[model samples]
Target chain A: MNFFFGIQNNLFSSKLEIPIFKNDGTFLEETILYKLKIQDLEWKIEIFDKSKKNNFFFHVNSSDVNNNDIFFIGRHENLKKFKSNKLIVLNEFTSLVPHGYHYRSNLRVNINKGGFSSYQSDYPYKMTPVKGSVVTSLASVTNFNADKNYIFFKNIYELPIQENFKIYIVDLKEKKIKTFFEAKTNYSNFFEIKKEYILPEMFLVSKNYVGIPIYISEKNGQISMEHTNPPTSNILNSDRIDIVKKFKRELNEIIN
Target chain B: MKSLIRKIINLDFSIQVRNTLNIIPKGIQKKVSNQSSTSDAFIWRTDNNFTTKFKFSDILKLYFKIKKSHVELHFYSKFNNLITIKKIYDLDFSNEVVISKNLLGGIEDYGVFYAYHIMDEKKSQNISVNNKCYTGFSKDKEFYSFVHGNTLVRTFDYYTNNQNELVQTSFIKNKNYLIQKFFYSSEKNELFFTNPASKSVKFDINGKNFKLKKGHSKLISINDNFVKIRSNCFYFRPIAFTYNEKYFDVYHC
Candidate 1:
């Protein structure tokens, strides 16, 4: 039997951060942030040392993310009160058509909750579009629906299809343990981050093979995982070293 | 558990279909799938680059030969079937046409967005639509409409945007009326319906009004921002206006 197409083939593993604070204060880079405690699917904040200088952290006891049912601990964006937060259950998983040929795991995430705030950011690809050409393999200025945001891979690239993404949520208190979020769910559609808001490096390759990209993004008081696409070496008919150099220059322009 | 169940069902169904088809002869299966062929025009090399050359036929026909290694299980080739062919109007090479490929996908999709209006350095024109963004074209011979996924956003023509450096005008398909057409004024960002259901019907895009009046009930833009609804004899078919300027299709109905 030719059981072709619509099959999830690849495995992507990455870590996501959830930051929590005890009170409203000027968020410093070195602020001692509180952590989270997880018993099954319920999340509770863990109290940390007020004077202890450490990275903003959290905790998750469940090491087997694949076996356990995972949920997002989203805090209220507008509400100053921490108690206004609630757990957003993974209601449904909508599997969009497989966008890549080689790297198969393509999952879009969309989150929903009463108080949870949603923030968006764009991470341009390390490699800019070829000079004098407005289109690139990784990013483009999309005018659809008057959405001027830079679209990083609005659709999946076709050949040498090697890049795909897996989403992982790391507990702030437990730095070693990680959890995976499968976009396919039962109750509601996957929480799809808008294409414009998705930074290209968020789903880039690992350091050993493709050069790893470090993404830096901050919204409200959260120090989210920063990642970007590695310098695009696999572009067809393009010199790998030249692309890497061009991407470095472009990345510097975007960063500075 | 749900995915597992779905997987098992899909496996079972595929097996059944395979077994049923196996009863038929190989020649019959080939006939069923390969209705059209480009044997004479196909050019292939042993490089295994999976690059199969296509032969241009006419304004409406495109002959594609799928390489053996590149034949995807779902048939989404390197081109991904996103080629557009536009017929050249009022040109020296009246038989020539342009071919364009959309740069819609991410880096992994391989090819970049490029349009070739000249086959052999001479001007050519042709137009084609992407099946991903359009629906009902292959099935309906007379009409083509945008997919349901394109209900909110107008169909984008990236080939023209890159080639001509003009504001990209989109095609708004009115599914209700088969003959009535809709074109977007890129400068004004207004949707101009060639035929309105009624004379008083009004259309709005981002607070801009395109009101249809009595007599013609069609919208045409006189200038960048101003659009007037003229009824009979004034309305013309929407063509690629950025590339060809001599075809002054203006009339005051």
Candidate 2:
């Protein structure tokens, strides 16, 4: 049975990565992988050079392997070599059954005495397997401290090629649409949302391609990171596909 | 014959039966357009100096010229008791509901709140019936950490006036687990579990045992990076809250 399972190749790969934030404070980042019921699961970690010239693959120390999971903690000295680079984890497992593995990139930062914040990476790989070109996405903006809030767009691809797209910020209250920012695939983009643009009925939309829109806010020493859900999550019935199509069509018509 | 045997071994029949049953009721009530609705079980926190709020919008308004629409928030206590139900009428394109002790009749604690959309069927077309909104958590009013609903745990049929619970037992048990890794360096690492099942659910993190009654919630503290959970329920993922001194982060794990 194990031999047949190994030869069947019924595994789907889930790859996720995040760019290391440049902070003056003490920062530590690690990739945490949780093992479920996948038998003989295989995984790897790769680091992209800041210059975007080289990709290096390394192995996690055997000591870091716990009873049911693996932790690939980054070293300060080694991470300095690729500052602002990307750390990617690729996990291949058979999702044929109902069980699967979970992994996330965890970061801890300490700026001042008794000041610390921890964040977990939320962007899962969405471009791989090339589902489609257009996606309707929505996310809320957190403008607690206007000057300290920034929106991060991390678009990754299985292939090394890059694609250009524009993100539209839709103000439902004002009934207007504006091109907020232009981003390239395979790169991490960050920009500050003006305080004037932040309103109660505000949401970000992307029509060209799909990427993770992460809201990050920092005040004093605390930092909060979160991502938005796909538009289809609003409906739970089997006919959600048709409903989402209508929703997206009407939304695009209104925006255009 | 060999392929049929393989399919049977994979529990294809059981899955097909479950899917058929799920759609049969909807098919029978297809005439009642208002009966279709989608809902999510949101987490509400008003305990230990933590405040929770949910932000939503009238997405169906984009498709139909909505005459009237509102959201029904069914608030539950920590013990899974239905405490209060608040209705937000005449919603704008965007709105928010701040969960507070006073709003919940001074029931101060953490629990689950299920929010569903209610619209005037005569004046509007009900294509999409729910807005799976985002929930925000704040401490001391410093900053808000927001996250969306993680699963579709429950749904309400307006025509039949029946609430359907979705998260429950799977065909196979003890074959699945929910696991997450957290750093031990944080001052506090807590995992919030809400039982959406109609019956009680039994699960354990690491070796510590816990039993959560139907619709109840429990918060467990973790001091290690390696955490494993085994539960009888299908969707047993928990919301993770990590606090380091004055800074904290909340997300679905």
Scored by TM-score, the top model is 2
Residue pairs in clash, model 2: none
lDDT of 2 by residue, A3-94 (tens): 00000001111122222221111122332222211122223233322221111112222222222222233443433333123323332121
**lDDT, candidate 1, A1-256, per-residue tens:** 0000111111212212222221111122433223323343334444332332123322222221221122222223312333212322211111111210111111111111110111111111221111211111111111112212211122111111223332332221222113222321111111223444332122221111122122212122111111222223112112434544554344223322
Off by over 4 Å in 1: A1-103, A110-141, A144-235, A250-256, B1-253
Tens-digit per-residue lDDT, B1-253, candidate 2: 9999656533434443443343211111122235455566788988888888787766556444464767788988878789988998877766677787788888668989888777666333345455567888887554677776766666676666577665544332342343423335546888899986665777777768888877888888888655667666656778888776666777776
By summed lDDT, the worst window of 10 consecutive residues in model 2 chain A runs over: A1-10
Q: CA lDDT, every prediction?
A: 0.21, 0.55
Mark the regions of model 2 whose C-alpha exceeds 4 Å error after superposition: A1-91, A94-126, A129-141, A144-147, A173-175, A250-256, B1-34, B63-67, B122-131, B170-175
Give the Å error, residue B113, model 1: 10
Which candidate gets the maximum lDDT versus the true structure?
A: 2
DockQ for all models: 0.01, 0.23
State every prediction's TM-score relative to the real structure.
0.19, 0.71
